[model samples]
Target: MPDSSAERPRRIVARREGPMLVEGPVEIVLEDGTTVSSDRFCVALCTCRRSRIFPWCDTSHRRHSPAARPAADH
Candidate 1:
């Protein structure tokens, strides 16, 4: 029989310039007492304060470099 304690341990990854990745399913309780849950295998928690989906990673942390921006017409 498989050892119950051998199950994968939960992990959280922090990035200096991006969101915090967390092993899910996870539930977050806000200061307002609201609850949010994510059942994904991994969840990206927003750190840039720019996500449309607050507290979640919407990939808004990507750099808006000039090369990545659309060219303006002359």
Candidate 2:
């Protein structure tokens, strides 16, 4: 077995209104038992489920924002 602490840490960058950037290549298991992976040097993971490509960001979060959303009438 390998020591987890001894391994170099993977970096993740969280954006305020968008996807999180992670160092790749990474493998992920979904809630439905499906798996996904990316071999890119970096990967953008959707924090918001607005992605057409789930787990992978498609910049869909940019279409609407908390600040940009229209206010509901009282």
Candidate 3:
């Protein structure tokens, strides 16, 4: 078993109106039940599921904001 502890804390920067910028070493779990560990310098995660990448943000929030958009439109 691998020790899954926060060795190097990744910085999660939440934009006031967009995706969170995750920088540094981190682990990622996909909805499909797969886990990936990476030391990638940066990753953008969606607060909204508008990303074609699903969990990761491709900057789709630039086009629309879930908080501002009407629920019926979703």
- Give Cα-based local distance difference scores for all models: 0.82, 0.88, 0.75
lDDT of 2 at 46: 93
Residues 1-74 of candidate 2 have per-residue lDDT tens digits of 23549978889999899999998888878999998988888999999999999899998898877777878999
Best by TM-score: 2
Model 3 stretches astray by more than 4 angstroms:
1-8, 66-74
- Quote model 1's TM-score: 0.70
Candidate 1 lDDT for residue 64? 48
**What lDDT tens digits, residue by residue, belong to model 1 across residues 1-74?**
23538778779998777799998888888779999998888999988778899889888768543455688999
Tally clashing residue pairs in candidate 3.
0
Error of 3 at 69 (Å): 11
For candidate 2, the TM-score is 0.79
Listing every candidate in turn, what is its Cα RMSD in Å to the true structure after a full C-alpha superposition? 5.4, 3.7, 5.7
In order of appearance, the predictions have TM-scores of 0.70, 0.79, 0.63
